[model samples]
Target: MRSASAADFNATRFIARLRSRGLTWVLAIAVVLLQYPLWLGEGGWLRVREGAQKIDIQLALNQRLEVRNASLLAEINDLKQGRDAIEERARNDLGMVAPDEWFVRVVPAQSVQSGKTNE
Candidate 1:
């Protein structure tokens, strides 16, 4: 028979004690309970990752809004400071005519743009 070495003897005694005291099950439950807060808890890595993704989405939305705001601000400043901008909007959007200009709008019977030539 092969003699048990000190390492093997210690390991054997440790397993026996664990089996007798049911420490294996207690340790397993303790480890799982401790891991709960790290993986599935509110302040855990999963929640942190989700929060980071939300922050990234919000930051991108804010950047796009900022660009749109800058464009609106430029348009507002142009309308405030320039007569040409105001005149262009009035002429195109409201169909405003000058006092000396003739407003001649010819009504088309057949819409010439939709593959129909009024020839």
Candidate 2:
């Protein structure tokens, strides 16, 4: 009967130790589950990094557009202030020739083979 009581005491102590270890394991799992969202969830580090990359791309595009806008503004000012610039653009872009001026074009001749021209 004494040996039986000692066996019971030993079993109880083992069960108590097992319960403590189980609680620790459960707490560790809970901590990991809670932290999962902080690193990989929506609006997390990866999302913020992607947002920053998009912002950088937009800023670079905006800078390029700003430069183009400045160039267009300068061209506008030139067109408004100078007749020479307007005349140059008209002559180049519209192929406008002055009075009494003749336009000429020169094209390369195609090779002839077997008495027929290769167009």
Candidate 3:
């Protein structure tokens, strides 16, 4: 009968739709699995980028330390080569003076009113 053929046709269409949907879901899962290693694995882009950032930070620290070392070396050389630098440092830092001389300080009136003294 005509009603039986229509029922059969409807069942056929439903099966076809289910099969297509199954294939689509399988392909989607496959794509996700393939992308996992590229995005989250040990050799991924994020790890490489993180390593590059760490290298940059280390290089910057090394450069700053080199500059500091150079300045310290220069100071050491100056101290070793002459007594002038030592004498100046002693006079400024320790307030030292010659045995025959006196140490005098002159302060401004404004500093006195502000309650500030020489460090």
Candidate 4:
């Protein structure tokens, strides 16, 4: 019975020591308070990294679109001012021919021959 009482006294003393400085409680509170903002906050490191990746993708897309837009604008301007540009666009896109020009489409014929057969 004395040994049990002594063990109880030791446990009570340890609890008293823990309650004195309250260091463990403070650490627990600090971790609990900081956990959400660290891992789940919008401005956290992971969110920042994701935002940066999105911005990079948008920047690349904008660059590609800008290049495409410049090409289209140049083509539009050329078509507006240059007769040769218009003619080239029409000849290529519209399959146009001048009055004296003939349109001929010649296609290569496919032949299935085995081994060393020759024509």
Please give the CA lDDT of all the candidate structures: 0.90, 0.89, 0.93, 0.86
Clashes of 2: 0
Which ten-residue region of model 3 has the weakest summed lDDT?
37-46
- lDDT of predicted model 4: 0.86
Best by lDDT: 3
Q: Write the per-residue lDDT of candidate 3 for residues 3-112, one digit (tens) a residue.
A: 98899999999999999999999999999999888888898888888999999999999999999999999989999999998998899889999899898899999889
Q: How good is model 3 by TM-score?
A: 0.73
RMSD of each: 6.9, 4.4, 2.9, 6.1
Query: Which 10-residue span in candidate 1 carries the lowest summed lDDT?
Result: 110-119
Best by TM-score: 2
TM-score of each: 0.67, 0.76, 0.73, 0.72
Q: How does model 4 score by TM-score?
A: 0.72
Tens-place lDDT digits, model 4, residues 29-111: 99998988877797887898899999999999999999999999999999889799988988988989989999986544443
Q: In model 1, which residue pairs have backbone atoms overlapping below 3 Å?
A: none
Compose the digit string of candidate 2's lDDT tens values, residues 33-117. Answer: 9988888999788889999999999999999999999999999999999999998999888989889889885444443334545
Q: Number of clashing residue pairs in every model?
A: 0, 0, 0, 0
- Which ranges of candidate 2 are over 4 A from the true structure? 106-119
